[model samples]
Target: MANKTAPDSPPGSAGGTPTRRRSERSRRAILDASLALVGEVGYDKLTIEGIASRAGVGKQTIYRWWPSKAAVLLDAFTADVDEYSAQGLPDTGDLAADLKLVLRATADEFNDPAFQAPYRALAVAGANDAELSRAFVDRLLEPGIRVYVDRLRAAQEAGEVAADVDTRVAAEMLLSPFSQRWLMRTGELTYDYVDTLVDLVLRGLRPGS
Candidate 1:
């Protein structure tokens, strides 16, 4: 098997640091190549050899870092996502406002051509491949969804949401509608639409008097 790291650099010498830097650069190039190829050729046609060729690295270099094409795609998607949402979830102490803020940002991301192509391709591919589906959900989807779970828990603790509500289900209320519209292209994902979803969720889940 290929090694992801360069042959061990001197344990603590400047001479070895450049080798590690080159390895890191190679890894990033592989990811960028994967993203570009997925957009150019779609997920089904993407291959390790193609990625290696595009990245200008040996196949061993990719295999050393990632186990499969799905793994590479998932990493590329999340890395791109990190660039856009590096701040993490919002927490302004108001659940409705925070939900709206996050959803609007998400909506904008979905609408962005750079994000949409790969995301839509992965979503479609995951539907048929169980391994890719698992990686996609575990690495990408659930982490994004967990933002809502955390925010809802905060709301419950703040006495803004009902203590008995199932946050897992509640989180879906915010995400599902938007996802449906986005995937189906049935309606506009405007700020008003997301604001309404937040209002509906808060009104339905708020603690009773």
Candidate 2:
């Protein structure tokens, strides 16, 4: 067992001179701590010391890597870029099907208790903290959004999408519906719901138009 106790020097203090392996462990611990704490406490009562205790690390170790709590989480979300590729939607060339597939994936991610608890907590916190909001958008959200944008652009080039469609806005239309559902808890996210949204957006919702 490792002696994980650490002495913190306040919120903004510099950290200890941890060795490379120890530093990696601390980083992992801090990231895990911040995310877990935010999910459980919803950011309002999330304290540095709390994260330290949960992570089995020193509070100072966290400060060394991040200026703030949100920053710690932001890094954790983006730490493994490969996860995005592995977990994100796979493009299958059919625009409508691809959109549905992606939306379904989004629903799966959003509805998960493990994923949702942390996501909702962070999203709520970001609403109140400009720095956290920007970090969230840049680190966790925008990269995923850009993947859709790229896929849509490819669809346009391949003639799968309408030639005049605004790929950016179209991309938003596809993803935003699901996001709205998740953010507001307005309804359950479902495969059928995502498929319906994809159909409506692609073919229009009018009865006979």
Candidate 3:
């Protein structure tokens, strides 16, 4: 058979361009490195140089995608939360049960040692950095909050929640207490605590409470 050269492939036709694949790998490495380093060194001690070194990428590469170490950590944290939020709040037709289930899961996540270090670091960093604070609220916090809002809206339509209830406020009410407790270390984030929050919030949102 005669030797022949194959035609050039399009950017995303089969396996994507080598540059695109390499960029994605670099992005994943950067995000993973940021998370791991934050957990290991704490965010105060974390730097773009540290992330670049850990990711095996140039500092310029990280700067090309994120403005600061806080921004990198924000992206990393958002990526981790995206995996869980993708499933959203459960809708078992019983709003109280679903709220308790999700809240308890949240308590468990907050209680986990591996999750605590990086999460607390992110929380503290967001408090000091205005841009990072906005990004964290916009990217990570609001989306997670919306999951609750959505579930509540579903309950409203199902006649489980009162029609007059403000789902957004109700969602915040359900979440803010646990968040305060978890972030401030004011109290234990136990399943019982979250279940109580669920019951209390549900009682207020019910038709005749």
lDDT of each: 0.80, 0.72, 0.81
Model 3 stretches astray by more than 4 angstroms: 1-19, 83-86
Q: Ten-residue segment with the worst summed lDDT in candidate 3?
A: 1-10
Q: TM-score of every model?
A: 0.84, 0.79, 0.84
**lDDT measured at residue 196 in model 3 versus the true structure, 0 to 100:** 81
Structural RMSD, model 2: 6.2
Q: Native-vs-model 2 lDDT?
A: 0.72
Q: lDDT at 189 for candidate 1? A: 90
RMSD of each: 4.3, 6.2, 6.0
lDDT of 2 by residue, 1-209 (tens): 15344333222223455644566677776777777778888878888889889988776666755677766777767765436744655668787877776678778877888778878888888889897788777776777787877877777687676677776786688778778888988887889888888888777422233
lDDT for each residue of candidate 3 in 97-150, tens digit (9 for 90 to 100): 888887787788889888888888888877888877888899998998999999
Instruction: Quote model 1's TM-score.
Output: 0.84
Off by over 4 Å in 2: 1-22, 80-89, 204-209
**Two-way lDDT contest, 1 vs 2, winner:** 1
